[model samples]
Target: MKTLLLLEWMKVRKYKTFWAFIILFAISLAGINYFIHNVQIQTKSLTHGMADIQIFSFPQIWSTTAWAGGFSVLLLGILIITLVTNEYSFKTHRQQIIDGISRKQFISGKWLTIIVFIIFAWISYFILTLIVGNHTENISVFSGFDYAGYFLVKMAVSLSVAFMFALLFRRSGLAIALYLVYVFILEGIVKHFLDKIAGGLGMFLPLSAGGYLVSNPMRQAIPGIETIHIQPVWILLTCLGYLILFVYLSYRYINHADL
Candidate 1:
């Protein structure tokens, strides 16, 4: 276990590009927060009515964190995908195998690092929320707590997704590019089609359904979309299913994959 951790740490330390992503993550979050703050300032009067009333009686932190961590997940996904893909792209995996690092340990160590970073990002995001808004207005301690939980679970799910993508593509650039395309383009288009075909069932599309567990209460309250208000229980189940399915698939693939 110690050796696996050490190896993962070494991978992180030796990679400058991977480190560069931290700056990008910070910048993206800052930009989003700045935009949201400005909009809030302009519309403060309109939104003041909803401040005290808690819309989400059965609030799931996972949903809140997923909303806040949306951008973080995008950034982290790219980083993780790249990190895993680069190992294969650079032939580092073969060397690690040669050094007697079992595939299971390698996968476990990477996942451990991912979990640590996910927690760090979640805390950082919650802190940023507090920093960007007044403590009494536009913010609540419960909201922060809820979002933190969401971010942690979202990170776990995203890590599993990244692991699968990395193992499949085995090329950092390809994995990252594909992920970006899927997020920015494919998901939007696919979701629309699915929504039409399956009617209400389409709201349960993998990413969209997982999204329900972590979305902001306000955003989740938009009218006319009946299925959008997926119950917290359903959201939890969907997320769990995705996590288990992807982890099992990635594990099987990585275990049998030729370095």
Candidate 2:
């Protein structure tokens, strides 16, 4: 596994695009959370404490940061897609196979790369939560930390979805275009109609299920706001199911398809 990951690292070590996306993802995560923190402070000052919600305080910070961090996860998804499609574009995947690595190892190496990206994201979120929370309020560091776990699962499902799309299309442009459309447009549209047809079943969609794990932290601050109530266990299971399915499909495709 270390060998496989090292090989994957060598491919992207000097790739400017990879670093660009990584930096972008990091900036987006920090920037968005900073913006929200400022907004929360401004609201407190304007409302004179009536509307002040302690979103940045301990437990809430975990969910708030996780929810806000979801937007940045899209950039990581793009990174994964680009990395996988680059393998096809440069014919490096075939080269690795010719070098006597089995198909499973190639795919395993890619999955390992995805795992690394996911860990990076998780650690980033954890550090951001601690910094933001401590600056806002000193509370139990581990309180509501399970949201960090949910964020990790969300990253796994999202990046795996990107990986599957990249393997299926083998073209970065098309895969990324379709990925954006699905995440930003199609899923919401389909989920809306599905909800209209059958209440909350729309959350079962792969990305939707992942998203269901975390919700808007400010939902409680608004008066008379209604939010869907789904058990966390179901959502977690749904995300894990999709994660497994996506990995299986990607492996199957690359295992049998022509390079």
Candidate 3:
């Protein structure tokens, strides 16, 4: 696994765009959280007892950061698509195999890179939560491990879908644009109409199931907010199911492609 990661790193080590993504993801992650925390502090102080809501207070803070952190996964998605599809675009994917790496190893190396993204994201969330929890409130670091766990799993699913899209499309720009369209516009539209005929069906969509994983507690407090409630277990199962399908199909696609 380490060797696979090394190989993948060699490919992107000098890639300026890759570095730009790292910087962007990091800055955006921290910046957005800092912005939201400030907003929460300002507005909550005006409301009686809202200050004690624990939005950024330790245990609950873990979940809050997780929910916010999910937004940046879109960046990672674009990153993976650009990186993987670039291999095909530049014809280096074939060269890697010509240089003695099997096709399976080639795919594995890319997968390893995605796994690193998942781990890096998890660690970022853990560290940010740790720092904020310590300064904001006295709380157990491990109190909401379950939420953290779901965060990691949902991220894995998100990355897998991105990776699969990269493999299928092999055109970075198209893949990234299509991914955004499907997730932000296409899926939402499909879900909106689907919900009218069959309640709770939208929650089963790939992105929707992932959203069900890390919930925003603030949404629950809002009156007249209509949202479907599904069991976390079911949502998780749905996510895992999609993860498996995506990986299998992506693997099969690349394994047999003419690249």
The top-ranked prediction according to TM-score is 2
- Candidate 1 lDDT tens digits, 34-79: 5544544445456664433233222333243346557766887888
Model 2 sits at a Cα RMSD from the real structure of: 1.7
Query: Which pairs clash in model 3?
Result: none
Q: List the residue pairs that clash in candidate 2.
A: none
Off by over 4 Å in 2: 45-48, 135-138
Model 3 alpha-carbon miss at residue 218, Å: 2.3
Per-prediction CA RMSD (Å): 3.9, 1.7, 2.0
* Cα lDDT tens digits for candidate 3, 1-259: 7787898888889989999998898887887788878877766777765544667776777778888888888899899999998998999998888998888888888888888899998898888888776443455578877999999888988888888878878999899999998878998999988888898798898887887888775675466888777789998899989988987887787688898
Residue 26 of candidate 1: its Cα lDDT? 77
- lDDT of candidate 2 over 1-259, digit per residue (tens): 9899899888899999999999999899999999998988888898899888989887788999999999999999999999999989999888889999999999999899999999999989988888878543456789898899998988888889888889878899999999999998999999999999999889888888888787788777888976788999999999988887887887788778888
| Cα-based lDDT for every prediction | 0.67, 0.88, 0.83
The full ranking of all candidates by lDDT, starting with the best, is 2, 3, 1
Please identify which of the two predictions, 1 or 2, would achieve the higher TM-score against the true structure: 2
Candidate 1, residue 233: the lDDT equals 72
